[model samples]
Target: MKRILLINPWIEDVSAYDYWLKPLGLLYISSALKTLGVEPVLVDCLDRYDSDLLSYSSGSGEKYFGTGKFVETVVPKPDCIASIPRRFKRFGFPEEVFRSKLQQLDHVDGVFVTSMMTYWHYGVSDTIRVVRQELPSIPIVLGGVYATLLPEHAKRNAGADLVCPGTGMKPIEKALLFLGINKSVQPDWFDELSPDYSAYESPHYAVVITSLGCPFRCVYCASSYLWRHFLRRDPTKTAEHIEYLVKSSNLSDIVFFDDAILVGGGFKTLMKEIEHRSIRTRFHLPNGVHARFVDRETADLMYANNFKTIKIGLETSDRALQTSTGGKVFLNDIYRAVDNLSKAGFTYKEISAYIMLNLPGQSEEDVLDSLRICEELGLSPTLNEFTPIPGTLQWKELIERGSFAEDIDPLLLDNSIIPHWWKQGFSLDTVQRLKEAAWSLRRKLSGE
Candidate 1:
């Protein structure tokens, strides 16, 4: 029997919070391996329920709506940013715990490691180093956003035998063959395999994606580079999987990780199925939704189907900026969507508007205008600092215009750095003022 091990690497950053973080791509690979009759074991570093790690934390790991914090440990700063004057930490199990977990798995034929956010490659590098020391001969394969975007950099620095990119499973299949395991698992994307989260121990929430990729090519987003094309699963089958998870696992919270959920009536059809089956669960879209798609009918369906959390992308009120950055939503579109959702009984607190800040040429006035607009519409404003992603339009333009260094390390792409690291003309003080304005609006709206 071929037994493979999968590891979700720790997140190394100045600050981190668990906003329903799960290695969905790695879980899909596990599910596909299972379908091919291969045994798979998982070591999720960010498992909040792990009693050993929870024992070290100051607070119990209870979560609200399946969103919470990860138990973290302070770690040394990378030499590149040592003078940044912030406490760098690893947001997950301690190193000893990870090593102990790896030691427990016997006869591991091969290993698969996954990464997120390209800038967190330090965590990926550290995880691979530990794996090599423990299982010297076992071949390790790396995959995920970081691997896909910066394949050569990850291959050179991540210390993995092979780096697999994109959604296809061909590279992994080939890696297994190289390891003397002769079996072929059809790619899960074609079959639309439901990720088997049963491997998790008492998970509070499960993430499901009815669709993959977005049609709109946002300048700052890398969805097109990672996915290449938009593909959606059968809505009926998606509803069935959701029903199974809710009933069997006694779970109430399900998050949609789709880059864009409403490609072609996908959201409406899935909601209708859930309503017909009477599957009552709180749906969440931490990934922003397209404001233009939310009409009167869609809003009512979302409310009827119990969408507890809804975030619409209104990146900027500047019409030119909006047009250049995919133009998926207009000012009128947001206004109408909020109106429809409000009429359908969703309160202002339930609807959140995502306003992007700290883009290449974004000004303080632009950001402040967006916040004021959201406040006027009675929607909670959430500020998202822009990160320059590789292979995106913004990245290419930044490099061409001499705004960003061409040879910049991916680690510097942290969103937290904001205007200080990647702005065109904004000062740190201006960025601070913008954050303060956003916070004040949020507090006033919440009546805090």
Candidate 2:
């Protein structure tokens, strides 16, 4: 059997943290590789559960908070990202530990890497650099959101031997086939297997996905970038995975990375099944939940199922921004949804509404107004700046009107580090003042 290694790289960013955040793409790919009869070893650079972190991650050792803090080292910020105020970190284990871990694996055929948030491509590059230094000839293939969105850049600059864009099902099979590994058998699509989290060399949280893809094309989002369509397993399958974690692993909190979990999709039928069966599990949807689908009954179902924290995408309170950006939700929808969640027995502070700011033509007044509106609805406001995703409808306009390079580096795709600061009718100071005003209102609204 040919040995294959899958690596989930670290994060290079200003003020990074983890919240049940697992690389679902990597886990799914790893599971698929095993199904193909490829003996795979999964290496995670962002190991909060590193055994060496006896004092930090655990005492004599266990990971903290289900998914705990990363072992990060403050590094020099890249030239492209230096303008940002905060010190950035390379979030993961020490380089020596990574190297030592790699050396232990014998006769690895090829290595596969996964990436997320386009801005974090540097972490991917850094991981590749380490891997190449240790094992010169092993082919390093990169895939996931960033690779899918900017394949050319990933191939050219990110140092991957080949980039697998979009879904890795066909590409991974093709990758294995090229190496002369053929499997005449197929495994169950719902691989209820607990990801070989044991490969981490430390006790830590696991990454699992209940479904795939989001149904809507929110102009600024890349949910549709990786997967062109949406699909979900029978809730029974997902529930089984949850049960496995709770019963076997003794995990209490798991995060759902689904973009639109219950968005009028077949999720209702399946979610209902899990609830009716009264599965004793507590789940978290740390990825922003879709507000438009939150009818009173759905809210009640989610609440009864022990979903503790819920975040909604109320990108802007302005009807125009809501309709124009995603056509996914609007003002009346926010009002009704908030009412539903509130009636379903959630305190205002228990919920968060993600507010989108800094879109190319978005107004500062609109940004603050959106925050104010969230306060009125009695939900905490979380501001998420708009970063233009390539291949989306807005990508065309950013090139036409903004300061973005026609050849902007893919690393500039990080949202926390603003890439495209827009001018409201050519007012340069508008960006600064708008951000300040939004922050002020947030403080006042939350009574901080």
Candidate 3:
């Protein structure tokens, strides 16, 4: 039997929070391997419920829905931006604990690591360093958003024996072939694989993905770059996965991480099946779904079926910014859509409007007006800081701007600090005030 060590690496940044994030990509690979009959062991660095971490922190020791702060430690800067005035941290288990955990794994033939935000390659690099030091010669494969975005840079810096940009199921399959293990059947994208997450202590959330990729090629987003094509599953099959998780795993809250859930350019039959028969499940879309996809009929279908958390990307009120951010939707479209959702019988509090901020040359006033629009539309405004992704259009603009060097340490692109917050007169205080007000209003609307 092949023993594989799957890792969700530590996050290195200024500030890190648990916003219902899990390594769905890594878990998919883990589950896929298990279904293929490999012995997969997980060593998630960001396990908030790790016995070593829980032994130290206060507050009930742990929380549910994979929502809680990670045990973090201050670390030195990467010397490129040592002048940046903020404490950098490694958000996860301590190194000693990590090493001890790795040792406990005994013997593993191979390692699979997952990466998130491209700039967090520092975290990816550090994680690779530890893995290489411990195992020395286990063929390690790196794949995920970071690996996908910066393939060449990661190929050199990540020090992995093999690097998988985007989906590397083929590469993984090839490696397994070399090792004399063969799959009787090929791995299909939509075929549901049973994931056993019992290895991690108190793993609570079940990630239920109904589809893959997005149709909209938003210039700022990497969804297109990652998958390049959109695909959906048989709704009956999707419901079956959700049913199994809820019934067997006891995870009621299942987050759907699809780029667009209901755009059903295909699989309309599957969607109708889900609309009719998906059993009790609390759905979440922390990644935010496209509002344009949700019509009165579809919204009603979602609400009636299984969706609990409804979030949509309204980007901003400024029409120019809307076009600038890829012209995904117009202001009036959101207002009418919000009306339809309420008419379909969902409360205003259940609706969330994602207001994006910190674009190149965007004013604070622009961000504020977007927030005002959300407030007026009776939607909760969730402010997300913009980070310049490497291959996106914004990356070229940042390169044209001052002092941004090529391959200059990925840590500068952390969204929390806002690398290029240089729009004339915008103060951090003003940004903070806008965010605080947005949160307060959202809470009031939520009545929570």
Superposed model 1: Cα runs more than 4 Å off: 55-60, 187-191, 423-425
Per-residue lDDT tens digits of candidate 1, residues 1-448?
A: 7888999999999888878888888788888888878888888898786665666666535568877787778998888777777788998888888888888779788888998988899999999999999999999988888988888889889999989876667766776787777777764454468888888767768888888788888899999888777888888989999999999888869999888896678788888999999998899988988888888888999899899899999989888888888888889999998999999999867899998877766777888889989888889888888888988998999889887786677767686643467537567787778889988998999899
Ranking by TM-score: 1, 3, 2
RMSD of 3: 3.0
- Top model by lDDT, which number? 1
Give candidate 2's whole-model lDDT: 0.72
Q: Identify the runs in model 2 with alpha carbons over 4 angstroms from their true place.
A: 55-68, 81-86, 183-207, 413-415, 418-420, 424-448
Best by TM-score: 1
- For each candidate, what is the lDDT? 0.84, 0.72, 0.74
Using lDDT, rank the candidates from best to worst.
1, 3, 2
Under the 3 Å rule for N, CA and C atoms, how many clashes does model 1 have? 0
**Once superposed on the true structure, which residue ranges of model 3 sit more than 4 Å away at CA?**
51-66, 174-187, 192-201, 265-278, 401-403, 418-430, 443-448
Evaluate model 1: give its TM-score.
0.96
Pull out the clashing pairs in model 1: none
lDDT, candidate 2, 298-397, per-residue tens: 8888788877668887787677777788788787878888899889898655677887767756777787787778768877777776777777778777
Give candidates' CA RMSD values in order. 1.6, 3.3, 3.0
